[model samples]
Target: MASGTSVSPNANRTRSGNTLLVWSLLVVAANLRPALTGVGPLLDRVQAELALTPAVAGLLTTLPLVAFAVVSPVVPRLAARWGPERLLGGALVVLAVGVAVRWVPAAIALFGGTVLIGAGIAVGNVLLPSLIKRDFPTRVGLLTSAYAAVMGGVAAVASGVAVPISRAVPGGWHTALGCWIVLALTAIVLWLPQLRTPRPRSEAVHTRRLPWGSALAWAVTAFMGLQSLGFYVVVTWLPQVFRDSGVTAGDAGWLLFLFQAVAVATGLVMPTMLRRARDQRAVAMLSSAVSLVGYLGLVAAPGWALLWSVVLGLGGGACLVLALAFLSLRAEDAIAAGALSAMAQSIGYLVAAAGPVAFGLLHTVSSGWQAPIMLMCVAAAGQVVVATVAGRGTVRPTRP
Candidate 1:
């Protein structure tokens, strides 16, 4: 994260100002969550065609998430070798390919393709904050807010259009998911310019302050993982959970939609507020506490789940934004930010990947929602400790 001691001659391609880069990043950001949320609404169509059972159907939804978790740990290593820009571009290609493969008629191929696609997304997901961290160092909070809003807005669009997109095609799920691949390609096209940026000197690239073996780095990564655990869990399984609690699928999806939609609004608001605080501990605690309220409400009063869904969504949404922002907040340089992002996202996502499956298994074993609901609370409580330590506001690797 130290300033560029220098740029490797081959590394610099098209040097551009931060303004243009931020704008470009925003465009990419808009594409982030759609590939994920878009396919969910069409899961039923997907299952029908494949003749997957209820459990396998659950795996279809859970597969990418599992892939996401599994792929995160390898991101930093990939970024280190390829450079963040190249890595980001490559990840988009992976996403496009993954989405494309979902349309293949074979079952093993479908699952394999899902893993490929999920892995691609996991790579891209970790890289974004690093891009923001490296490029918009001064505007971490504001830029983070923008990125968060883009994620939220796109998720809503994906959810809203999922059914419509599927209905438009006979092979609804295949085409609907395939549609996401196109978006991923577009993001790659926009990102092509970054890949052309000149690489910095060895000293800049290897500097420890921004990336590896740092306290802030670990904190940010852990926070990201914890928060994401809640968010993806809801995204993947919320509809089923609601239905089990007596809500119809339509009502349940709408509840999930509203939660994500409103979370987008809250996502924009949180970074500004969080930045103003000396440390992020209070913000993290509040975010987790609000999520707790939602979890409790949904469990105790199915009648009230609709209202509390708003609260839960808001907290989970903010958690995603905050976790990403930590890359920028903690890293002194973009490269460093990228490294930290890779680490946090990669590790954090793996942690998150367990939520849906574990929750499902818990439901099976305990014969009720109590265990899973309690698990969510415990996850939030753990955040309090991690966030407090992470939010201390001092930079690690101060030598840089």
Candidate 2:
């Protein structure tokens, strides 16, 4: 029997509509990362201004992961009630407000704003793939590439210019952080048209039981966790690592920027690379191996941090892109994709939230970077173990 599916009959309204949709995708993708990555470069300034301890400073990064974990499970139900288009548009509006909320000079406001930002991004993270699965079903690879690239590229830009913007603007780090609101607001404006696009009505969807005990499911979830751990840890601490190694703060920010910049290219290309491979085990191992080498390099030589950052960037970028692809690739339908995504990210981000906090505590106790870098090495090994299985599994289609 044919399945009921909802699609926009006029999705390709005109040359103009197609162009607008593409622009809207890019802008929304661009909004997903900046609010989070923008804070990394400004962490030191925030810490000093707020008189926060190292552990507390680490929470700036950790809070978002926690929020992602906390909010991910609830997204599917919300999407069902509100529709993906309305939910996404609402998320952008909330994101813009969250960015603006940070403009007030208070610690409570900062953390509150971060929580809101994380919640908003969490919605986008869950919906974007499902949206791609819906609107660009046949062009998943290309569209995913474009989405990931824009996200990484803009995040790199945010990391690069954060400090300078802080200095040049009236409110220092507050303004630097708040500047992301403009982009979010732009995305919301571009996204409004999507709200007008008609969706076909269908019967109520029963919540499908997720495969909790499946090895492939566990593998996908673990791979997602480990990749997220690597990226969040590096983004949170790489600037500090370079600064401690005698690189100036501005240069360190740029190094972190370079790290994310290199990642943009890899994120853009990994999907095409995956499509060519018979199985992803070799590619998965290679990704972990590169990251392991990069982590080892950071452990052995702090002075060559820039080169190591790029290597780590390439590896982390590949893992992230691959993990995201697995959400779509491992599921056979939109509902299954939503279930897999919710399971992978809800649990995955809870696992990931530990990376920065643990690293910070380890650094505090050991009084060195060695222990943290070793922990990152362990994470890379874990990624290899999980991805080997997840990367090889065939898709399992489920119905609600």
lDDT of each: 0.70, 0.83
RMSD of 1: 3.6
Instruction: Identify the runs in model 1 with alpha carbons over 4 angstroms from their true place.
Output: 1-19, 44-58, 61-74, 199-216, 395-400
What's the number of clashes in each of the models? Answer: 5, 0
Model 2, 183-212: lDDT tens digits are 998999899988985442445433444657
Q: Please report the TM-score between candidate 1 and the true structure.
A: 0.86
**For candidate 1, what is the lDDT?**
0.70
lDDT of 1 by residue, 1-400 (tens): 3453212232332455555566667767776677677655555566677786544655655677677667766665566556767877777887778778877767776787778777777776777776655544567788888888987888877776676666678775667666777667778787887777655444445433334566666777778878887876777667767777787656666777888898888887886687578877788778877888888777778677678778987888777777777776776555556556666776777777777667767877887777887788788878767887666553444334
